[model samples]
Target: MAADTAKVDPMHQFAIEPLFGSDWTFAGHNIAFTNSALWMLIAGICLWIFMIGGMKREVVPGRWQMAVETMTGFIDDLLEANMGKEGRKYVPYVFTLFMFILFANLLGLIPLPLAMAGVHAFTFTSHFTVTGVLAIMTFAIVLTVGFWKHGLHFFSLFVPHGTPPLMIPLIFVIELISFLFRPFSLGLRLFVAMMSGHVLLEVLSSFVIDAANAGPGYGVLIGGPSFILMIAICALELLVAGIQAYVFALLTSLYINDAEHLH
Candidate 1:
C-alpha cells in the first residue's frame, strides 16, 4: 500500500495519447489526432475569438474588446521597441505567434479532460517539438527578412563590426555557432520551464491526495500545506506562462532587429 502510494507518475501527465478509439496512421505517418493537437486547436480557436470576434468599434469597449485592444497595444509597443518602423510590416505574423503561444500556455493551465479516458490535461508548450517548430519558424522569418532586405550582405551578421584582422575568423566561427543555436535555446527554455512546473504540480498534487487518504491527522499536517503550496505554484506558473510568451516574442523581435541592422 505504501509502495503503491509512492508510485506517483508525474511525467505520465505529458504523454501524447491518441484521441480517437485507436491510433491511426496514413501513408507512413502516425497522424492521428492527439491531446496535443486538440489543445493546440483549442488555443487557436480561443485566440481567434478573443482577438477577432471582439473587434467592435464602440465608444466604451466591452470587456472582450478591451482585452483585444490591450493585447494589440502591448504587442505593438514590443515590436516598435525592438524592431523600429520596419516592425509594422511583420505585425500580423508576430502578433499571431504571440497570441497563439500565449493562448497555448494559458490553455495548458486549464484542467480540461481529453477525449481519451485517462488523460485530464494537455500542455502543448511543454513539448519540445512544439516550441522547436515555433522557434524555427521565427528563425526562418529572420533569415528571409534579412536576405530580402540586404542580399548576400546578410552574411555579415556573423562577422563583428570592429575586429582585428587575425581575430575575424575566430569571431565569425563563434558568432555563427551562437546564431545557429538560437532555435534550440529558445525552444528548450520554454519546454523545460513548462514541463518542470507541471511535473512539480503533479508531484505535489499526488502527495496531497496520498496524505488525504492516510487520515485526518495526516491530511491536516501534510495535505493542507501541500495543497496550499500547489496553489501558490499554480499562480506562479500562470505568471511564468505569460512571461515565457512575452520573452519569446520579444526575442523574435530582437532577432529581427539584428537581421535588419546586421551588427
Candidate 2:
C-alpha cells in the first residue's frame, strides 16, 4: 500500500527541482538552475536543430526542407486569413510560438529519455507561471500594436461597430471585462489541459500497478484494461498537443487582427 501510494503522486511530476545544488542563489534569492529551465533549454536546442534544416536553401527541397516549408506556409496562411496582408510581419513570432509549444508538449509525452536517466521529463507548460508569462507576452503585444497603430481610437474596440448608442455603454463594460480575461484564460487553458491529462495518466497507471501486484487474475482484469486505456490516452495526448499549440497561435493572430483593424 505504501509503495502504491508513492507511485500515485501525479502532481509530483510537475514539481521543479534545481539541477544544481539547492544552495545556489543570487542576491539572496534562490536562482538555482532548475529542471524546468533545463527542459526549456532542451526544447530550444531541438527547435534550432529542426529549423536549421530548412536553411540550406537547396534548389530541390528535401524531406527536411519540405517539412519545414510546409509548417512555415501553414502559419503564414493562418495569419493571413486572420489578419490579411499586414499579417506577414507576424509570421516569425507566431511560428516560433507554435513550434515551441508543440515541441514542449510532444516532448513531455515521451518519457523514455528521462526514464533512462531515472527521472521523468518535465513539461514546463504544465506550470501556470510559464503559460501565464506566455499569455501576458501575447497580451502585451496586442496592446502595444493596438495603441501604436490606432492611438486612442483603439479604445473603440470595447464598443462594437453596430452597437446602438444607448446600448454602447453596457456593451462596452462587458467587452472590456472579457478583454481583460484573455491572458488569464489563455494561461489557464494550457496549464489545466496539460496538467489534467498528466494526472489522469498517472492515476490510471497506479491502478494498473496495484492490480498487477495483487495477482495474475487481477492483472488480467484491472491491469489489462488500465494499461490499454493508458495507451489510448497517450495517443490522444499527441493530438491534443498539436491542437493546443495551434489554438494558441490562432487566437494570438486573431487578437492581433482585432488590434490592427478594430471593429
Candidate 3:
C-alpha cells in the first residue's frame, strides 16, 4: 500500500507558485513574485558577482579573472564573426544575455532536491513566457536598429539586392514571414529543449524509485538501468544547457547582424 500510494508526476516541478504573495498588482494585473522570479534574481546576482570578479585589474590574472575574460572574449569573437567590428558595441547586452541564460539553465540542474525541503528550484528558461520575452527583446532591438539606421530602407531586408521583379513579391513575403516567425521559434526552441530534458529526468527518477521499492529483482532489472541512464542524461543536460545558451546568443547576434548589414 505504501509503494502503491507513492506517486510521481513529471511535470510537477515546473509549477510556478507565488513566493511572497499573489496580491501584487500593477495596472490591474497580478505581478506577484514567484519561484521563477526568485531564480531569475539569483541568476542576475550570480552574473554580477562573476563580472565584478573580473574587474580586479591584476597584472597577473587569476583563474576567476580568466574565466570571466574567456567568456567575454568568446562572445566578442562570436559577435565579430557575425557582425564585424560594429559588433563590439553590442557586447554588453549580448554577454549579459548569454550569461543569464547559461546561469538559468545550469542552476536548474543543481540536484539540490529543494522540493523535498519545501523549497522550489525553478528554471525560468523552461517557461515559454520567460523565453519568449527574451526572444522578443532581442527581436525588438533588431527592429529598432534596422529602422533607425536605414529608415524605410529597412524594408529592403525582405527583398534581397538584385531580386527579379516577378520573384520580388514572393521573396519579400516569404522573407518577411520567416523573419517574423523567428521570435516564436527562438522562444519555443529554448523552452521545449530545457523543459523536455527535465521532464525525462523526472520520469526516469520515478522509475528508479518505484522500481527499487518494488523488490530487489525489479531494482536490479529496472532501477539500475534507469539510474545509470539518468546520470548519463543529467550530464548531457549540462552540455545541453550550455549549448542552448550559446545558440540563443549566437542567433541574437546573427539577427542583429542582419539588421546592421541587411544581408
| lDDT scores in order | 0.87, 0.90, 0.94
lDDT of 2 by residue, 211-232 (tens): 8888899989999999999999
- Over 1-263, each residue of candidate 3 has an lDDT whose tens digit, in order, gives 76766678889899999988699899999999998999999999988998898999798989999989899999999999999999999999999999999999999988886667857567899999999999999999999999999998999999998899999989999999999999999999999999999999999999988998899999999999999999999999999999999999999999999999897
For candidate 2, the lDDT comes to 0.90
- Highest-scoring model, lDDT: 3
Question: What is the alpha-carbon lDDT of model 3 when measured against the actual structure?
Answer: 0.94
TM-score of each: 0.92, 0.95, 0.97
Residues forming the 10-long window of minimal summed lDDT in candidate 2:
1-10
Ranking by TM-score: 3, 2, 1
Candidate 1 lands at a TM-score of 0.92
Top candidate (TM-score): 3
How many collisions between residues are there in candidate 2?
0
